[model samples]
Target: MTTSTQPQAQAKRDEHTQPQAQLAVFDMAGTTIDERDEVYRVLRESAEREGARFSDEEFQKWMGTEKHWAIRNLLTIGGVEATDELVDKAFAWFRDELARTYTANPPSPMPRIEESFAALRAAGIRVGLTTGFSRDIADLILESMGWTVGGGEECTIDVSVCGDEIPSGRPAPDMINKVMEITGVDDPAAVISVGDTEVDVESAQAAGAFSVGVLTGHLTKEAFAAKNADAVLELAADVVNLPQVAAQ
Candidate 1:
């Protein structure tokens, strides 16, 4: 079953606070925040239109991949012989559907996400967004929520690493490192990486940062643990309730 909301118990994430805590790096799509599975949903439709079919498993694997990589890799793994033209076609379809989905049924923050973000800010922690979303989509999500970059009246994050901005995607520390550079948080120990995949965990570990695995995206607990994450939980919102995350 698709996990829809985070539990209240998981909301008590104020427990693990150190005076020197510097940054909280959040993954978009299914970690710290998300409205719906728009990308996956749209991709499935596009695949069908392209005379290809996607299984549930296949879709899950594609959930948070960078757009270019997701399209290219999906075509490759599916033996579809992807070309730039074909990938562009697929992307065009996805973009069209994305607008429709959001316009009709806009997505909002994942459970406790806003709360946790607020809590982190209140506690003086710098917040950053690292996502596999295309820049256009990422901008939409932030704009829809009326958030700005850098905490002000808006839900400003200190840094945002969009899929289009990075040369390497998840399972690599490039995105996280970008965030650290933006936040000026040199010590990995003072940073916490929250995401929903093995790639996210591996990336955090590669960056020497603590990792929190949230089961809101496409991965399972076992899958997350296999990568050696520091903690496993339900959602980013749940982190707000966790003493381990919220306490400072």
Candidate 2:
């Protein structure tokens, strides 16, 4: 069965009390990379191969979550018996397909996202990438994009946190917490988390960081507004224009 949307108290997005972010964390697919439908394409093919079905809404419910978690949800929604072995096998299949497709036609970063990265670095703010993809796939995308990771102080991304690295994914605050720990950012309020899904906003809010919803990703303008992101931007480039970001 699909998971219920359990309500939780969301941390307030108080502008006056919010501190400028020292580090900015961005999601990979949709938010940073233009692999919007490509991800779902692989997902659909893999699910069909495994006899699972997914409508748009069904697929959307797993947005911003780990690939394995999404696979399990898809299996449950498709009425396929979700066995541990089946889930594992299905996840492996999905990963293989995704890696093959990504290898053939690697996605490019979204428009002005690179600009935002450069601008953030120029202003002495660190940048990190968080993704629902596991380390291997995340690394594959980074390598394909020619982006560097890992360094004492200077690297293209400074650091990256993958979904598999944490116990849980978006809406749990784990991935953001991992990023904060890796980057040594003490105050969660001094961080900005950007993603393209409702869970992304929730994750940021739960982590006590500035939440930014970009329009280029999984969420539409109206959907983003409904999620109550601290700020909504037409694209990633517009993030630099936010007061919280600008003051950084």
Candidate 3:
């Protein structure tokens, strides 16, 4: 064998010895969990409080953007003066509405989410979450779903990187990078980031991580295709049984 072939063979051997430390990052609301339209739904309901009305088209366009960006755009397009307090108040209303909705209709684990996690764990791979939802909200969702990080009778997620945890949010690579920092994983090629939006794909691509897109969320499969998504599939429910995921 040639000198160059040795490293490739060794790498393959190493992969079999270890679970490959394949870190997987998931987006919360809409991606791995329910609560689709939660943002816009809350925005529309909070219109009266903001003294404005949000256009459905415009709101849909801002799907993957952070809450602040969406709120800023809503105010700007509505010709309303932007103030720190006003922005804060608007988001507060959205959160309040979200909390109410969640209390009444808490999100259940996405189809196959538990199965996918179990498979990854069984394989010794680590799983983490990256979501636009605030850490506070993330905590609530996890608690409701009974997710534990280490291991248990149920499931354990390795880590979570939330929007508020870092200065920059999705469409930025910071969240994924933070997951890397927390997990101590260095190679992006070894990591697979999954989500249901362009922002998630962009973040993964920016971080040089393999990206998986899903049609389970707000964005269509074609939308993910347009972003040059690495792999497109059904919801997390389908993740566990896939040959690709199974091989991973």
- Each model's RMSD to truth, in Å? 7.2, 3.6, 7.7
Q: Which stretches of model 1 miss by more than 4 angstroms?
A: 1-20, 151-154, 240-247
Instruction: Tell me how far candidate 2 lies from the true structure as C-alpha RMSD in angstroms.
Output: 3.6
How many residue-pair clashes does candidate 1 contain? 19
Q: Compare the candidates by lDDT and give the number of the best one.
A: 2
| Tens digits of lDDT, candidate 2, 93-160 | 88998999999899998887877887887787788899889999999999998888764344577789
Residue ranges of candidate 3 with Cα displaced over 4 Å: 1-21, 47-49, 52-55, 151-155, 240-244
Residue pairs with backbone overlap in model 3: 111-237, 112-237, 148-156
Cα lDDT tens digits, model 3, 84-150, are: 8888888887877787888788888777788778778677667888877777777888888888765
What digit string (tens of lDDT, one per residue) describes model 1 on residues 29-98?
7676666667677766776667665567776666666766777767766668788899888888787778
TM-scores of the candidates are 0.83, 0.91, 0.83
**Which pairs clash (backbone N, Cα, C closer than 3 Å) in model 2?**
none
What TM-score quantifies how close candidate 1 is to the native fold? Answer: 0.83
- Residue 123 error, candidate 3, Å: 0.7
